[model samples]
Target chain A: MATMTIAKAITSGLRAVLADDPKTLIMGEDIGKLGGVYRVTEGLQAEFGADRVVDTPLAESGILGTAIGLSFRGYRPICEIQFDGFVFPAFNQITTQLAKIRSRSSGMLSAPVVIRIPYGGGIGSIEHHSESPEALFAHTAGLRIITPSNPHDAYWMTQQAVACQDPVIIFEPKRRYWLKGEVDTESAGRDAFSAQVVREGTDVTIVAYGPLVPVALAAAEAAQEDGNSVEVIDLRSISPIDFDTVTASVEKTGRLIVTHEAPTFGGIGGEIAARVAERAFLSMEAPVLRVGGFHMPYPLAKVEEQYLPDIDRLLEALDRSLAY
Target chain B: MGAEHLPASEFDIEELEQSLVTSDPADAPPLVQLMAPDGSLREDTKYGHYAAHLDGEALRAMYRDMALVRRFDQEATALQRQGQLLLWPPLLGQEAAQIGSGTALQAQDYVFPTYREHGVALTRGLELSKVLRLFRGVSNGGWDPRESNFHLYTLVLAAQSLHAVGYAMGVQRDGDDAVTVAYFGDGASSEGDVHESMVFAASNQSPVVFFCQNNHWAISVPTEVQSRIPLSNRASGYGFPGVRVDGNDVVAVHAVTRWALERARSGKGPVLIEAFTYRMSAHTTADDPTKYRELAEEEKWRERDPLLRLERYLRSTNTAGQDFFDQIAAEADKLAASTRADVLAMEAPDFEDHFANVYAEPHPLIREELEWHRQYQAGFAEETAGQAEGEAR
Candidate 1:
């Protein structure tokens, strides 16, 4: 076991996959030589050579489109969108082509590609750099979206995303990139898609993913001082959400609150609330509430605290659910 | 070029094999014209070298292929009108463009085509009936693209250019030296995907041929509106060679496409061939060309019909006789009739197929949706049972 930051874990995961498969290639703007904006891919270009760790031109559509083409040639291409906001330039290719090729060809073709993007808010600086756009990709039909909250998952899930036969998008939690945790590098890795209940409780259940996982755990610990029990479930898989574990938790807790860094309006929380309500209707003690950012573009760093969801908001949401 | 850009492929997926069926060649560019509308041979030294493979028998076969595909297109259109198909995109006047370019490809090559590549599908040996399953509403796409190396028709404009480029890049990596063709129309040049696909293709030196059939109309929009200049000229801007060919002339199209494909397969980077052709038919069965275009314009194009010039040349040279023409006509009719029967008899797939392949692996959401559908379908039996009990009461 080794203590490492989430960024280092992700870099290790990328390194593992590159070593495992010669067909695997990494391409994105500044991913090579510069080692990515976050330096998550640092030292990779030198280790793997420029051919495997490629620095692509600045076209997001071209990155994805050519990646899809490379996938056609039996090359497992991992495409990195330099930032979350920049993914929009390639949105048409992602939605229309990347998401449909497998079904469009009637099972004759498979686009084995992975798209990696540093997503979510906190480090706030630029116009479009910090945003949680997972909902947009989750809504797309032919994609699997995953977000890892800590170093261990960042390590394992990155490898799993590369190993998946279907197209996958790994939305790395940008805020949690520097956070350190113990990573068991020897383990084969857990099922990357399942939701893990990080804490046990009976009064209420707070579900979150990616950057929000640690926040939810803190909320649970804070609630303990108030003599109220709270459960925290980390959603590893974003698109095909692990509702099996979530529903079981809701059945036991009888109350739920979904949280994320994305705006609550049409966010992934809505999908979770609706599904939990449908599947665990009889077990519900109250309407499943949500804690998320305000309905606006990610704010600048100065006031980002007011816009982001923190422990106070999670506690407020928890109190409302328990009061019912 | 910007840092984000690579030198793009020529023409935005807009190569069509040549001969524009226009009586007014006065406005047409000096393309690699091998056959004049007056039933005489007119060739250039460079292009003539490329088409040397077109002996009398080969020329006759090209004529037959064009004729048969045209007939198949007509039958499919008729089926759409008869409510057997959802819609049909007819490749009426652009037959020479599709047939010539498609025939120029080897079976090992991959093709990414726009929806109107019925003739290309024919060249790749896809059963015409199977191609109609998409139009017939029974399947998402009718044929296995890998089996024939012909990808499913891309309805969206210029989207396939990137796929073709990436596939070509793959072929380059594998050292297979196989060609990949991306087919689109003049209007598709405006798409951002096309821009990026070209850049990626050129940057990687991928073996792709951008075959843009400038059929002069994108739905109701004219080709002139899409570009102020000829589409082929756009290739030079991307730092690749582009050529204009008479799309109405099969020989010119075959020769140009052969040269382009050869250059690509030889690792000489990409080529863009603009077959400046005309779309004689409406965009699809749903369109009314008379609403936007002039019948007089149609009449003018009809005077320089692709089949007419070829037939005239064949007759003048005695390359084929009445017996051969009669035999081909009969064969075309036989194939169309059988295809009609097959389309008519095609069954709607078992409902299970819908949920089965949503993912290569089993998915919970799909399985749940499938169960819901099954229950919905089974509700009728429960209602029938309830009705019987009520009647007995």
Candidate 2:
């Protein structure tokens, strides 16, 4: 085991995947000598040479389109979109081409491509940089969306995403990049799709993912003051959400509160709330609640605190669940 | 140029801007022609020898390929009219552009084609009946691309251009001499992905050939809307050679495509070949060219039909006799008849295949959904059986 930040863990994970398979390559803008905007790929080009770790021209569509071609040629290319909002330029390629090619080919071809985007907001960044657009991709089928909240998952899930034959979008919580944790490089404790239970409780279940896992844990800890035991489940995968795990937890806790940094309407939390309600209806103690951003755009950095769902919001939701 | 932003005293910005805005096809690169539209062979110093090795048998085979695919296209259109196919994209006049470039490719070369390359699919040894499965509504894709080195047809215009460049980059990395050919049309050339494809191919020096069949129309809109200049000239802006060929001339297209493929495979970077042709039919079964084009314009292009030109050249050179033409016609009819049978006999795949292969790895949700679907289907079967027993009672 080694102690490192989520950013370093992802870097290490990329390095390990490159070393594991010679066919694997890394491509993005400013990812070579300048190391990436966040320095996640620092020193990689020097190690892997310019061919494997390419610093591509500043076009998101070109990066993804060529990566799809590379995948067709048997190259496992891991593409990095510099930020969350910038992914829209490549959205057509991702949702239409990359996601549909597998079914379109009728099992003849599979693109083992991994797209990594540092998503979610909490660092007081600018407008486009600080947006969690995971819900947009989650709605598309044939895509696997995974986000790792800690260094351990960041390391293992990054490798898992590269190994996956289906095109995967790794929504790395940009806000948790500096959060340090121990990662056992030798063994992956779980698969990339399963929702993990970080805290054990019997009163109410709090479901979160990506940047919100830490917030949920903090909320669970604060709930002890009210003598309300809360269980926190980190939803690792967004597309094929592990409803079984969440449903199991909901069956036990009987009350569920799903939260995220994305908008509450038409968000991942809404899907989770609906599914848990359907699957565990008889065991319910209260209607499933959701706490997330508002319907409007990610607001100006000054008022983002009020816009983001904080621990107070989770506690309030928890209070509503207990009241019910 | 950076000099455009300079002061007037330093640079003639107004003159340069005027020259840049002015686009005349006559000013574009000279068109490559080895065969005149009247079926006369012309001698060219550069590309004439590329077709010099083709003996009488090879010329006859090329004629047979074009004739057969044209017949197959007609049959498919007939099937669509009969309601056997959902839709069919006819490659009526662009046969030479497809077969000539497609046959020029070596077995190792890969092809990325737009949806109307049935002739190219033939050159790749893909079963023509399989192509009908897509139109028959039985499959989205009907063949294994790995078997033919020909990717499934891309319908979203010009999207496959970048994929072709990237595959060529992979070939470069693998130290292979095979060139990847991307087939699009004049209308698709206007897409940004095509521009980026050229930039990436040029930047990486990837072995790729951009084969654009200027079929004159993108559905209702004419090629003029896509480019004010000849589509071939766009390659010059990206630092590569671009050649405009008489798309109706098979010999010229084959020769030019061969030259471009050789140049790319030899690491001379990418080349763009614009095959100037016309769409003799609607864009697809859904389109009506009469709404946007004139019968006089269609008649003018009919005089330069690719199949007729090839046949004239064959007869003038005594490369094929009347017996050979009759034999090829009989063979084409037989093949078309068999294809109709095969398409009619094609079956809808089992439901299991539908849920399968969406992901290579087993997905829990897919597994659960498949199971639920099985149970749902079983409920219907049980309901019918129970009703049958009630009738017996």
Candidate 3:
């Protein structure tokens, strides 16, 4: 076990994959010398050489398009989209090409490309840098979308994403990059697609993922003081959501609140809420609630704290579920 | 007409810019032609040597490929008209551009073709009948790309350009000599993906050939709307050589494509070859060319028909006798019959197959949905059985 930040763990994981497979390559804008804008890939170019770690032309479509091609040649390419909002330039390539190639070709072709994006707002940055677009990707069928809340999962998930045959999008929580935790390098406790109960309780169930996992845990701790035993579940993968874990937890708690950094309307939370209502309706003591951003766009950084879902918003939802 | 609104001067900046954009077919760039439209072999200093090695048998084979693909194309169009297929994109006038470049590729070379490259598909050794599976609505993709080193046809224009470059980059990484060919039309040239594809290919020095079959029209839009200058001229801006060839001349397209492929394979960087041809038929079965184009223009293009010119060359050169032509005609008829038979016999795959190929990994939702579908299908079978039993009683 080693203590490291989520960013460091991802970097370490990438290095290990590069060393293990000569066919693995890392490509992105400013990723080589600059070590990525957030320094997630710092010192990687030096260790792996420029061929393995490439600084591509500043075009997202090119990065993804070429990544698709490289996969055809039997090389696994990991692309880094600088920010969540900036990924739009490559949206056509992703939603149309990468996501459909396998099914379009009827399993004849597989693109094992990993697209890493630093998502969600908390750094008080400018526009385009602080947006959570996980729902948009999760809506696409062929892609496997995963997010790591801590160093342990980040380490293993990064490696697992490369190994998977399907193209994967890893929505790295920019706000949690520096959060330190012990990562067991030897073992990955669970598969990349499954959800895990980070904290166990019984009164209310808080289902969160990516940037909101820590917020859910904090809300659970506060609810404990209020004599509420809240269970917090961290959803690792967003697309093929591990509903079994969420349903099992809801069966025990009889109350559920789904939260995320994206807006509530047409968000991942709504999908989870709808599914849980169907699966665990008999055990439900209260209506399933969603706590997330507003329907509007991610606002200016000065007032983003109000737009983002934090511990207070989660607690308010918990209170409503308990009162019902 | 008002004096001020009358016109700009001939040498005015606006007039000069307008002159750069030509709708006139006569104002095309210099072309490399090994076989002239009059059925005679023309001499070219730079590219002539590439075609010099073509023996009588090689020439005859090229003619055979062009004729067979044209026949297959006619059959597919007929199938669409007969309601046997949903849609078909005719490669009527652009046969030489597809066959010439396609036949030039080595077995190891990869091809990324646009949706209308039926001739290219034929040259790549694809089961010509499988191409109809897409039009027949039986499958999204008809054949395995790995078996032929030919990618599935890209419907979204210019999207495959990037894939071709990326594949070439992979070849470079693997230290292999194989080059990749990406085929697109003049309309696809306007896409941003093409710009990025060229930039990456240039920067990486990837071994890729961007073969743009300039079929004059991208549906209703002309080549003039896509670019002010010749499409090949755009390559010079991207730090690579571009060549314009007589697309109707099979020998020229073959020679030019061979030269470009060799240049790319030798690590000389990417090259762009613009095969200036014409779309002799409607874009697809769904399109109406009479609504958008003039008959006189079609007549002018008919004079330079690729098949006719090749036949003229073969007869004039005494490379093929009347017997060879008669045999080829008979073969085309047989091929057309088989293609029609094959398309009519195609069966739709199992419904569960749709859910199965969505993801390479074991996705829970796909699994659950597939399981539900199985149960739902079984329930219907049980109901039918019960109904039959009740009727017997």
Most accurate candidate by lDDT? 3
Q: Could you report the Cα RMSD, in angstroms, for every candidate shown?
A: 5.3, 3.5, 6.6
Q: Which ten residues in a row have the lowest lDDT in candidate 3 chain B?
A: B1-10
List TM-score per model, in order. Answer: 0.94, 0.96, 0.96
Candidate with more favorable, higher lDDT: 1 or 2: 2
Q: How many residue-pair clashes does candidate 2 contain?
A: 0
Question: Residue by residue across A1-324, what tens digits does model 1's lDDT show?
Answer: 999999999999999999999989899999988999999889999999877888876799888888888897799999999889999988887888888877877677888789999988888577788898999888988888889988999999999988887889999998889999999998836778789999999989999999889889999999999999998999989977889999999999999999998999998999999999899999999999989988877898888888888999999988888888
- The whole-model C-alpha lDDT of candidate 1 against the native structure comes to 0.87
Clashing pairs in 3: none
Top of the candidates by DockQ: 1
Measured against the true two-chain complex, the DockQ scores of the candidates, in the order shown, are 0.55, 0.54, 0.46
Scanning candidate 3 chain A in windows of ten residues, the lowest lDDT window is A48-57
Which stretches of candidate 2 lie above 4 Å from their native place? B1-26
Task: Give the candidate order by descending DockQ.
Answer: 1, 2, 3
Looking at model 2 chain A, which ten-residue stretch has the lowest summed lDDT?
A269-278
lDDT string, candidate 1, B213-311, tens digits: 998889999988887777787776676888899999998899999999888888788888999789999999999999999999998888778888899
DockQ of 2: 0.54
lDDT of 1 at B225: 87
Candidates' C-alpha lDDT? 0.87, 0.91, 0.92
